[model samples]
Target chain A: MSDTKPLVDVRDLKEYFPIHTGWGRTLPLKAVDGVSFTIKPGETLGLVGESGCGKTTVGRTLLHLYKPTGGEFYFDGELVTEKNMPSLRKQMQMVFQDPYSSLNPRMTVEDIIGEPLDVHHLYSGRAERREKILSLMETVGLNAEHATRYAHEFSGGQRQRIGIARALAVNPRFIVCDEPVSALDVSIQAQVVNMFEDLREKLGVAYLFIAHDLLIVHHISDRIAVMYLGRIVEIADANELNNNPIHPYSISLLSAVPIPDPRIARSKQRIIPEGEIPSPLHKPSGCAFRTRCPYATERCAAECPELTERSDGHLVACFNK
Target chain B: MSDTTPKKAPFSMQIDPALFEPATAEEKKQQEVMSESTTFLKDSMKKLMRNPLAVFSIVVLAFILIVIIVAPLVVPYGYSEILKYNGMKDKTAMNLAPFQYSANEQKYMAENGVTLFPHIFGTDELSRDYFIRVVYGTRVSLAVGFFASLIVLVIGVLYGSISGYCGGRVDLIMMRIVDVIYSLPDMLVIILLSVVLKELLDGSKGIIARLGTNMVSIFIVFGMLYWVGMARLVRGQILSVKENEYVLAAKSIGTSSPRIIRRHILPNCLSVIIITTALQIPSAIFTESFLSFIGLGVAAPMPSLGSLANAARQGMQSYPYKLMFPALMICLIVLALNLLGDGLRDALDPKLRK
Candidate 1:
């Protein structure tokens, strides 16, 4: 990872959706606020957060899927703005969640995968295009016969593979896998995760793999970034973060994962956080997680914590940490 | 032989021997692969084909259309020709019928056999055969309905699709115009416009004279007036479909707006448009009939269903046979068309099958 340059650099990115309160007034819903990350060539950065923590919004904003309300995004060390978005999009692609709904049902699988090729003009002729599509399908473990079928005919895993093929058709250097296997069955999820690993090995592509499954993220990611309420609570090397999660949110999330070993599981205590995630429309004053944090102090409410690196490479964002 | 011998490779490098061997316990418990051939369209078509009532209605409508198309050739006498039975005493056949030989007619002409030969549906007060007039009139009713409805469809699709696709201020302005037009009674507009057009084209001797100077012009006037509602329906469908994820995907991929509309949005709205077209055919036919009945339709000598019905209504009290035949045909035709339309509505309803 150190030998290659960073493909994407995101700093303090924020996206706030307006919540209309009738009579022409609207309040801002801070979906992604002050989120920072970077992806090196041939590296996968896992973004794990509970529902509504704005992890998906971060992926979208990095690719400029939604125009950012605030912050800077640099692609290949150059600042990515709306003006050069089309060209930047050619380099950066996204694989959306819900593989079933992401691909157009009306379009054939070939057309779906061929769309990017058509847009980019990568092929010399129709035969070359067909050969490329077949090779791509083979790379993703799909048959040549499946090219003419519609998206609805494929299984959830196959659909995600088709989506991966579409993203790869542009020969993009970077990809944001936004919960690619979240909608698939548990058995299918492993196949998709393995496929992602294979793609990284074969193409040397970088990915910001967004998923709530810590186990899967740990298996595939070099580093993990844990988020809570639009802010990343912790980020560190995968093994280091799993061993010593200093943030209260990260600690609770790690504690919830059931161990496969009965002896280890019997000794470990589960730290289940109480209550639900707060609405972004009316976020708490200081630390957004203060409402559900077990270690909340009077100071935690008065001041927001800044992320600081510990002795190892693990970064924690809490006053006590 | 020794030099050409193949060396045995390591188990890891060779293709997995487990696949050629027996399956593992773990592999055996995996979910079975379900076939993925069934699609939305096939499922819908299957459901539609199973519906006996819809099939029956379609058959009836086809039969009616066939009758309408061939009515002229099948009928023996011309519409305006007087069919006199007693050779020259045309008065005897003023209000005649079949299966009933006129005694006075029998005494005048013993050569000509029966009164029924000349008048299949019998004659009216003018002694013109009712059957021949009704048959010829089918042509006028059908032509007006078909041509006018087509005009409405084209106008409606264009207006609605544009307004729906480019939504916001443009949509607001277009819809406001639609609302204003919709507020007025459709029938009144048809009547007023036809009357004015008829008056304007009267006494003009050119191409207008060749085609019923007033009739062709009135049909055009009515067709233009009927497309507003259809446009509104199409616009409503387009508004909903445009926000779907596939549309967003197309936009993200840098597909042009027109291509997105033509390929994605328009195809999604086809079911609604087709079902509406079927239903509107009867409406167009009814509108033409009403216009002719009120004496604002086709001019004298050229028979239409409405004009025939009008003539029938005049002599209904005395020569009742004149009114009954045309009225019956109108009811049967409209009823059959409406049933066919209902069947099509079910066939095209996506939610009904899937």
Candidate 2:
């Protein structure tokens, strides 16, 4: 995978929100603090974390929806900046988590999908625009008859499909699938996930799939990165991380994934952590998981751990691992 | 197992591959039980049609519009022209009763072999036909209401969309300016502007001279002060609508800021804008009438409903019907507009829809 250049390379991305702490003072809530990852062409990199761990923020910042406080984003070896964001946006797109809110309620399905085409002037004329929209809708498994209908008329799964069609309108090289199936039914999630996989195979598009569903992430990802608090603690191949997690947080997380067989489920050792996840507003010093870690040492609190290669293609950030 | 006795076949766990085949076009078409497609506007219009009160209001407004338009053509009397017979001022026509002809008009008709039009709502103190004046008054008031609201709509939508979409420091400063405008006394501004504009536009002819300084000042005041309400409303709406994931989706797709507001945010805010504009018309009409009542509306000889009512105030005891005519017209217009506005609010507001 390293032979081909990475389609998206994010380095030391930091996004801080200044929240008013009252009394004429403010504090920087470190939502995403120096998180970094890279996606090779046509690869799916799954980002898993608890709620409010900046999973969505990472996706948004990469797309320049919310300007990153500090970071360097290289897309196809070209540095993405404010000056070039409009042009670079053509190569990247995003599928939001919520199906209902992600589509403009006022717009018809045809208009929704054609918006990107209109913005980029991608089509030759009206007929070509219509043809492009219909083809895109068909690609996402939407009916041609459903084009003129408003967003409110569609079901949740169909709405998500329309959103997907809209994302695919520009033929983007990379997409940020931010919990795309999180707001869907279990039955529908499978269909959408399968469609995503099919599109990746057919179109050769890369994805930054952010979701907390470990099973879904494991099922679709080529590589998986485990995040704790605002930092990534472990990253490795999906099967390798699932079978042999190095970080304690990832260990606890994988242990929580339910097994189908009752025999294994009854015999499995559940490593429930000792404390609640610390608030990002006042993150703990040093290793964020140390307070909940079983093997917390004095050095763990004294210094923050850096991601180190434990084996081929496996990275862990911990002192006593 | 091979004996003649009924041998049970071994159970097979394998499923048929044919059942797993993709659905045919015929079957897929049957599965797609979708309703007829309708745009947002057409859907809203359907909902609006179902409302009987709104329908009735619409009919009444339509009837009133037709009456105002047609009455001028049929009445055969200019709004400001005094009643004259055989090219002479008919002094006896002053304060005549409804449908009555003056002694000179009767004599002149008898002599010239031509019958004259009677005063439909009686002649005013100035001997002008009151019905034509009333019709012209309705025209002036409706024009003011519509133009003023249009001015408010353009300025408010532009200002508010920019302020809300830009947000942060720009929004803060822009909103503070809106706050300052909101705090200013609207009535005082109208009076001051009218005083100044009357002098400045004194000799101007054509439409300006016809609208007069007072009407122009009222429109200016509406553009300046009245738009704050709409601006604040649109700002509040955009502030919330901008946070929706669709807006972020548009941004991620490289949609320009103006296009995002125009195609996405503004369309979502349409209900509020339509409702506010509908409601604004009545208020503007009322304000213009009130200003006219105080001798600050359209210039002299240009009859407005308020000025007509003011003229009728003196003859209240003797000719009570004079007051009734203009008063009833004003009431009907304002009430019809108010009802229409309410109906629009209920129809256009998606939150209020079933």
Candidate 3:
């Protein structure tokens, strides 16, 4: 990563959803808790975690789609306050996971993609707007003629492409691509991912790519951040993190990724983490991962490990590491 | 991977396939919606055409409405006009079988095998034309159906949407009120109100005596009674739709509640509302007619199907024509409306599409 000003610098961002108990009473469930990351210019930062590990929540919170319970965010060397959200939104966009949904079924593809343009008042006239929409569709590998259609008729891959087109419509410099290919077929996944990469290369855009598939993330991400129960356990350069995972959870996760070469796969012994992930509502006293960590000692249970850099780029949060 | 790529095309030189390929799923869905809308309307008309019974009833009802509207123009005689009669010992002329007069009569001349002139549906015991009364009766039945349903439409949509969207405590409270109202005897309330109004008007003097308690006020009573069922139906639909994923997506996007309800929720529920409204009109029309038949409806001499039937009920043996005309009109109007409602239901249901 370059030692320059990052496009998005999120510091200890948190979002807690409340669970109502009986009449008018509630308790907080910490969906995202004290997680921080930064995306350098023209870099893809992949947030890899299993379902409900708060990866999606992180992406949403960073965009201010959901109100963060805590933390500060800096966009382009400027602090992102509530007052500047509208203007800041023009620079940031998101692509959701579900190809079947996300795009409004009721709205035509043209309207869906042109919505951001409308919100930011980008185009000069109707003709100009249509021209821009067609261009965006071309960029995302969608037919310009398909603009008049609704979303439900498209295949999963095509719908994701439309969603990608919508995200790119405002000419945003950064996009939060939340599991862009997870819902697609095995054959179509690579196509959509390649299209995304081509768009990034052509437009020089940054992305906070959220996905559960570590292999896909490793392939696309310049750097990777591993999350567990709403906390970032480890973050480092993609190859370094994959080759030499320090944290137990990260090591187990990397070990579980199937090697394409049969010899290496047969030689490797996978390290499965102990037990199920504890509920976020009643997290462990110290490290949230302690309950499932095989290397958990007295110190690991007594205090939470801070995310500290051990080398030039490798950051890990583990007492044993 | 190499096999998938074109041999001549280098990186950044491949042809775009999205432009040449068949239309995407989204376009096809839109086409289906457009076609289905056309098909829905076409199918409704086709179905209506196929049901001969429904078609016949509609024709009869339309004819009745036309006759009622044109009664003032066609029937020149006033309602209370007294027919001058020369002294005759036989009072049997008062209850004569419509077109028949005894051949024994000398002074009274016969015209077209009948002495009486222009009583197409014969006359009542009082010698007033039953045909004219039945013709004018259309105005009252139609007016009640139209105005009462209008009120129901407005009230039901607003109440149901608010209750459904707000949910939780607000929904519970509104629903309880509906329950309380529903549990009451609706027809009894209407009957009692009509009776009280009738008595109150009877004692009043001056201008009231001149216009003499206009029958149009009966619509207001019926309109109030019909809204509860509509409100309940709308509320149930809204409750189901409000929980749908699309609704959740709207909320997540930070779209305001009112706009979501108006633009999204309302359009989705439109089909249901239309079907319900069509069905409601017939029931409301029937209710008004029933009330009149029991003397709690439009006051005497107003010429509602109900009034004509009621008058005929008392003199059925003496004047069978009085009962037959109004009864046929009532059955015809109700049956036609019901067929239209059934046709509307099938047309509006999206799942019914081929």
Candidate 4:
């Protein structure tokens, strides 16, 4: 990692959604609980987890899109409070997960991408605004001719690029990319991922790349953070975490990834966890993963294991690890 | 040779099939939305042009409007003018058939060596030109329909946007008010109000007197009752459309609520608004005709279509054609508006787009 101060430093963010059953009674759905991470000026942090593990919520919270139910977000060493959200939005933007639904159908490509510029007043005149919008589109590899087109006229990959261009319009330092390429065809995924990498290098923007696909995350992330039911199970350097995942949950997750070599792939064991994930409403008393953990013991049930550093800059949440 | 010289590159390098080359300039014209800028409305308008029934309806409505507006200016007789010359009633002209002239007119024309003009649709029992009366009746019905629908549109859009976008307590309170209004006996109230308003506006001055008491009362009833349907539709549309991801995206971009509601939410709900408003015109026209049938519409001599039909009913056995002209005009207008409404719904719907 670089020695420079982190561009985005988030500590112990908690987002609890209230579910109203009836008549003044409500239940708390802990979407993100005590999550902590930091991204340097140009670093990419990959967030990987299963569906409904609150991966998207983390990205949303960092950008202050959702009013963080509880957390401290420091963007470039300044605290991100509600009062500053309007101004801070210029420095931080987001690329949504579903490219199909994200862009407004009624708006033209020029207007979609120009909205950020319109919001920030980045340019002096109409010509300058058009120039900036066209340049942003070019950065995302879109043709200038695509400006007048509507969202439905474009393919899924092209639509994603329009979204990326919109995000880049504000010239943000960090962007929270929530599965920006997941909605594309598998063949088109690689092309989009390559463009993302190219744009990252060209623009020097950091990202919290959230996705459920481990392989896609592994390709572009500088560091990897594994989340299980809204809590970080393990976090480490990209190569270190892949080669040596400390948490039992991480080990099981990493093992699920298919190996190309036939001999080695045959030798690997598939550790599929038994039973469905326990509901967040009725989570296990201590050690939320213990319900499906093969090595569950009375000790795990007695105490909730906090994330502890096992080695230099490598953190794991299991007591055994 | 391999050691001494540089190795030749693969043949595929010069003709890379897998390279990320964009399409050539020649093929750019084939791209969708490439020719010129077009909005959802403009695109929908183009689609509307393609629908034969809708186009026919538009032409029909335009023709009716032009005739109603222009016919009175060129036609010599007033709709209510009792046939007379100088201070004497031309009694012989009463109940004359189309193309038939009075004896005096024919004799005067023979003396002057010129053709005497005939009443195109003949004369009524009161010896007034039937064609001009029918035209004036159409004008009255069209005006009432348009004004009523305009009132509904203005009130409904404002009320619905506030109710749906504000949400929570405000929405609940506003919606309950709508429910209360919806459940009320609307027609009865309209009838009562019409009676009361006519009494109040009777023989009034300026625009009120010009519109006549019944027309003014019809407008009031429209303002009170017709807006609820439009409001509910707009509210429902705003509720769903405001929840879309694009709305959230707009919010995340730091857009204010009012601007978002105007630029994003309202434009998205435009299809629903337009369809409802178009349908409202026929509905208001029907309501006016119904009220007029019961002797509650525009006062006599103003000659609304319903009044004309009512006037013709007394002598239906003698002059059946008198009732047919106004009745046919109403039928044609209502059918045209209904087709146009259906066409607007199909054209403007975002989901139906390719």
Q: What would the per-residue lDDT of candidate 1 be over residues B1-354, giving only the tens digit for each residue? A: 244445535552434433576778777766444344445467556766677876776676677678766766766667877655536646666767743435555654475554434456776667676667777677677677677777888999899999999997899999999999889888888888888888888888977787786567766775677788889999999999887756755555555678778877887787778777766766776777787778777877778887788877877787676777777777766676666666665765543443
Interface RMSD of 2: 1.8
Pairs in clash, predicted candidate 3? A150-B26, A153-B25, A153-B26, A154-B25, A154-B26, B68-B135
Winner by DockQ: 2
Q: What is the lDDT of residue B269 in candidate 3?
A: 80
Interface RMSD to the true structure, each candidate: 3.9, 1.8, 4.8, 1.9
Error of 1 at B50 (Å): 7.1
lDDT of 4 by residue, B181-232 (tens): 9999988988898999888988789998876767888988998898888889
For candidate 1, the lDDT comes to 0.80
Tens digits of per-residue lDDT for model 3 on B271-344? Answer: 67877786777777778778877777766767676677777788887767778877887677777777666655
Identify the runs in model 2 with alpha carbons over 4 angstroms from their true place: B1-31, B38-50, B85-92, B103-115, B205-207, B342-354
Q: What's the C-alpha lDDT at position A23 in model 1?
A: 100
Q: Best TM-score goes to which candidate?
A: 2
Model 3, TM vs. native: 0.76
DockQ of each: 0.23, 0.72, 0.19, 0.50
By TM-score, how accurate is candidate 1? 0.81
Question: Could you give the CAPRI-style class of model 1?
Answer: incorrect
TM-score of each: 0.81, 0.92, 0.76, 0.90
For model 3, state the Cα shift of residue B167 in Å. Answer: 5.4
Rank by TM-score, highest first.
Answer: 2, 4, 1, 3
lDDT over C-alpha atoms for residue A68 of model 4: 87
lDDT of each: 0.80, 0.88, 0.76, 0.86
Choose 1 or 2, whichever is better by TM-score: 2
Error of 4 at A244 (Å): 1.4
